[model samples]
Target: MKKKLISLILTLIQLSVDFSIVAASISLVIVIILVASTPFTGFAHELFDYHSWWSLVLQAVTASVLVFLAIIMFVGVHSLLRNINSGLYFVNQNLVAVRQILWPSLVVFVLQSLASICFRL
Candidate 1:
């Protein structure tokens, strides 16, 4: 019984650490993208001038990825904060069910709309 309990505690600890790193990564990546957006625009334009076609392709792909990451970060952080709160008040009286319109969903929706504009260009 003692060994089992020890292993269970260890697993929970590892899970928490792993989730913390993932949360941090998401936040850090979002900040990096927002901060570096302008500089990357210059690089994108420079690549566009190269006439490779692949540059534009790569640019589109990279931008889409960053947008996706931003959305994920937003959602993940929101969920984390919710979990840190007292309980799932808005959704259910229990902890098992939760429903919230998180910002990450909004971000993804906006990004997809912008993507359509990019495709038209």
Candidate 2:
């Protein structure tokens, strides 16, 4: 019964991770679309109050980086969960997936810090 319970929990986690992966992929597509259409549609100006081209560029770059990181994080999490579900929890592939998730999280933290400093300046 305990093994069955653990399998059920892992299955639930896998489902949630799959949903998150889909969400992240959709976000990536949306960010790409927004970045590409900003100049033509003036959507950033209207929605974000970005007055200058530089600000728009900065926003686009930041959004793209963030979306990419989110994708990486979600994908890594999905891989890790898949490994766990497959009874390979202590394998090297799982380690690589964990590193993939960790590095992206650290990058996001650094990116946020830099953005804060840039804004203050």
Candidate 3:
């Protein structure tokens, strides 16, 4: 029963990850389109005001990068979950995969926080 329950939970997680992949892809595409059309149209100016055009461009680019990272992270999670569901949870590759999922995001978080602080200053 415990195994079945775990499998069910993993299945739910898989579904959630799949949904996130779709959502992230859509967000990336939208951000790219907005950035691309920024100079051609008045959309960015209207949205961010004329004085903050550079900030708007920076934000849009940053959002696109984050969304791309999220998609990669989701794919990595799906791969890890697939292995775990198949009873390979304790293997060396899984350990490496877990670290791969964790450490980079931690670094990104730290860097992003520092960048925000510097920008504020």
Candidate 4:
């Protein structure tokens, strides 16, 4: 039980650290986009040209979701995959820690899946 708690705490730390790093990188991209929004009036015009505020809002939301998924894929999921493979043969030794990682991953997967579905139609 103590070990499980220890692993849980460690996983929480790892999750926060990883999330902050990924979010920071993606936020930089959004900053770039917002910065360019001023000079690239043409691009911004084209983006909001749909004439529907809802469409612009939806596009912005979609971009954010896509960026989020990319970060999860590059950082979170990739790291989890590496950890899984590394401990696969000895997983019984670290099942609790793996579970700690998986709960958030499943949530991330579901959210990303929901985001992608909106783009289908």
Candidate 5:
């Protein structure tokens, strides 16, 4: 019964991970297209003044980058969880997978902090 309960919990977690992957994939694609087409979009130019445009672009780029990073992290986590569910949770590769999920957020936080300090001046 204990094993059955553990399997059930893992199964639910896997399902949640699958849904998150799909959601993250769709969001990442949409943001990528938006960032890519920024130069070509009239809304980016005609809809805002120079400073406003620059700020908007900076924010958009930051968001796009974060979303891209999140997608990578999500995929890494999905792989790690799948492996764990398959009974290989203690392997060496799991460490790499854990790093893949963590390093991007740390980098993003550092970049965001720097950007805030620069903008404050």
Candidate 6:
């Protein structure tokens, strides 16, 4: 029963990870489109209160970096999940995958905190 329950939980996690990957991909595309169109549309100014082209550029770069990191993190999580599902729970590859996810997540956290500070100022 415990094995079955664990399997069910892992299956649910895999599904969640798959959905997150798709969502993150879509978000990346949308960020790219919005950044590409911002100069011409002046939407960033209205929406984000961007004061200048430099601010918009900074926002665009930050957003792109964040999204890219998120994608990397998700990919790492998928890999880790794959390893777990395969019954390779304590493998080196899983450690590497965890490290991959960890670095990106930490970077994302730092970047977000910095962004919040900058915006608030």
User: How do the residues 2-121 of candidate 1 rate in per-residue lDDT, one tens digit apiece?
Assistant: 856755665565466457656657765654554455344555555333334554554555555655555455445445444444333454432232222345455557776885576556
TM-score winner, 5 or 6: 6
TM-score of each: 0.32, 0.88, 0.80, 0.39, 0.76, 0.89
lDDT of each: 0.51, 0.84, 0.78, 0.57, 0.75, 0.87
Number of the predicted model whose lDDT against the real structure is largest:
6
lDDT, candidate 6, 19-98, per-residue tens: 99899899889888888888888666676558678778788878988989998998899899888988998889999999
Q: Report the C-alpha lDDT of model 4 over 31-113, residue by residue, as the tens digit.
A: 45744463445564464434444545565555555555455444644455445544453654355555555665676677668
Worst ten in a row by lDDT for model 6: 42-51
Tell me how far the alpha carbon of residue 72 in candidate 5 is from the true structure, in angstroms, after superposition: 1.3
lDDT per residue for candidate 5 within 22-62, as digits (tens), equals 89788878766766776678665553332555665775677
Clashing residue pairs found in predicted model 4:
none
Residues 4-101, model 2: lDDT tens digits: 89889988998888888788788878888888888788666675447477777677778789989988998898899888878897899999999999
Q: Residue-pair clashes per candidate, as listed?
A: 0, 0, 0, 0, 0, 0
Best by TM-score: 6
Better of 1 and 2 by TM-score: 2
Those runs of model 1 whose alpha carbons end farther than 4 Å from true positions after fitting are 1-101
Which digits, one per residue and each the tens of the lDDT, describe model 3 over residues 1-121? Answer: 9999999999899999999989999989998998888777887667543446676677667667777777877877888898899999788877776776776577568757865874575
User: Tell me, what's the RMSD of every candidate?
Assistant: 7.6, 1.6, 2.5, 9.5, 3.2, 1.5
RMSD (CA, Å), candidate 1 to true, equals: 7.6
Instruction: Quickly count the clashes in candidate 5.
Output: 0
RMSD of 2: 1.6
